[model samples]
Target: MSENMEKTIGEVGRVDWSHFSLADFLELRWRLLHDWQAVLPGGEYFGQARIGDVCYDIQIEWLADDELAVTMSPFFPHDGDSAEPPYDELVSGMPYDTQHGASLISSRRSFLELTYESFIDLAEHSILETVARFPHLQSAASKQTGFWDRHDAILCKIREQDDEDR
Candidate 1:
């Protein structure tokens, strides 16, 4: 996580969500997604994260003008092993079989609709909550094989380059 994000997490309640613009919210979203991708493997994006026994699938869609919908669903790992489905498959809702008779069952109550500003608030709160509840997500992710680290690292480097260019 970046220093700014850490600071934001520390002072979550004090931040004014209403003052954030769409671009600011998107930057925060990018950082949050990057951290999630770092911890979860097998997706082109940060769509899933596993904490202990339950895996969470995150989906976000732009609704209108500054409004966005975020859905987070927790499911037992597919076949009791994998925590993620492919990005394309997830977007398309493609069917695939799992092993050991396990299945994916999503609850309908895990949806939230908010403006981009409120979404940013949720993002900050979630970052703190994830760290508090699942401290090992990042450490465990370090031990797993995934492309997120490399991908995020490249993004970081590019951002650094852009900063230098400016």
Candidate 2:
């Protein structure tokens, strides 16, 4: 799909959960962690729209079942893996705690909405490489950082807000 179509799909936000569910999302996370092409091995998924770059896959690891992980991709680095540091190092490098950094990286949410929303756009923009260059981040910096110390609390608030909006 073209970038315009991708954006349209995102705007629609009409997901077919039957074909794609939370379990599938989790599995995708695991597969992409090791291989970018896990979703389309042999590049035979022609019927499925290309979501992101095939060069690299961004692995999203959720430490807890209640959290979210953000993986980026469109263009990936040529190295065996991205040069970016691990989530722990990135959190340690931050001035605040891990939770704070997680929020910052996640745009103030415990989880990010990347795969289902902008996957097609990512490929069209050819920015998957940029996404892959970043590390697979987790929400480890809970309430200690001054934002919401309780990761659960933050997640609850976000979920509530989403529900209200809906």
Candidate 3:
């Protein structure tokens, strides 16, 4: 079994989005979007460890608006030639830092990226659904959880609005 499979049982939980800046969010989002395939579809299985191992580089190009052009490659060893096919295909676009430069590739996508946004929304909804099952985590991020007081307050407000609607 791979390290990813081992680490990926049950929920991955909420990320510390506040820690990321817009640039950081974008980078993190890019990486997560890249690794989307590695993560088992709705099955929480880790296929392999990305650290110190050759893996596909998920590439993104922003043509205009928020639409991202995503591209990927097979594992290309870090020590391999830059002119190699995988590397060539992966690095073809302009880098994100440059105007019209393809977005810089990274191991982590930024908070603003769709990757994080989708993950957070899914996690929150899952938590709301299984509130009785995972009381600890939900409470920790809930209003009753003093440690996450601010987030908890927000959750409470959301719950209040939901209740009013229903």
lDDT of 3 by residue, 1-166 (tens): 3343333222333323343244544554544456544433322211111111112123444433433334322231222333433323222231111111222222323423455456444433432333323333223222321223333356568778889999
Better model by TM-score, 2 or 3? 3
Local error of candidate 3 at 139, Å? 4.1
Write model 1 residue lDDT over 1-166, tens digit each, in one string. Answer: 6565565344322322332356644643664445433422322223444333333445544334433334444333123244755222221222222222221221212222345656555654563454344323323322323333344356568778889999
Question: What order do you get sorting by TM-score, best first?
Answer: 1, 3, 2
- Once fitted onto the true fold, the runs of candidate 2 whose alpha carbons sit more than 4 angstroms away are 1-23, 26-54, 61-68, 73-111, 114-117, 123-166
* Pairs that collide, model 1: none
Please name the candidate that would achieve the greatest TM-score relative to the true structure: 1
The lowest-lDDT stretch of 10 consecutive residues in candidate 2 is 137-146
Regions of candidate 1 where Cα sits further than 4 Å from its true position: 1-69, 72-113, 138-149, 152-166
TM-score, cand. 1: 0.28
Assess candidate 1 and give its lDDT: 0.39
Across residues 106-146, which tens digit of lDDT does each residue of candidate 2 receive? 32142334564454444324332222223421111111132
- The candidate, 1 or 3, that scores higher on lDDT is 1
Best by lDDT: 1
lDDT of each: 0.39, 0.32, 0.33
- TM per model? 0.28, 0.22, 0.24
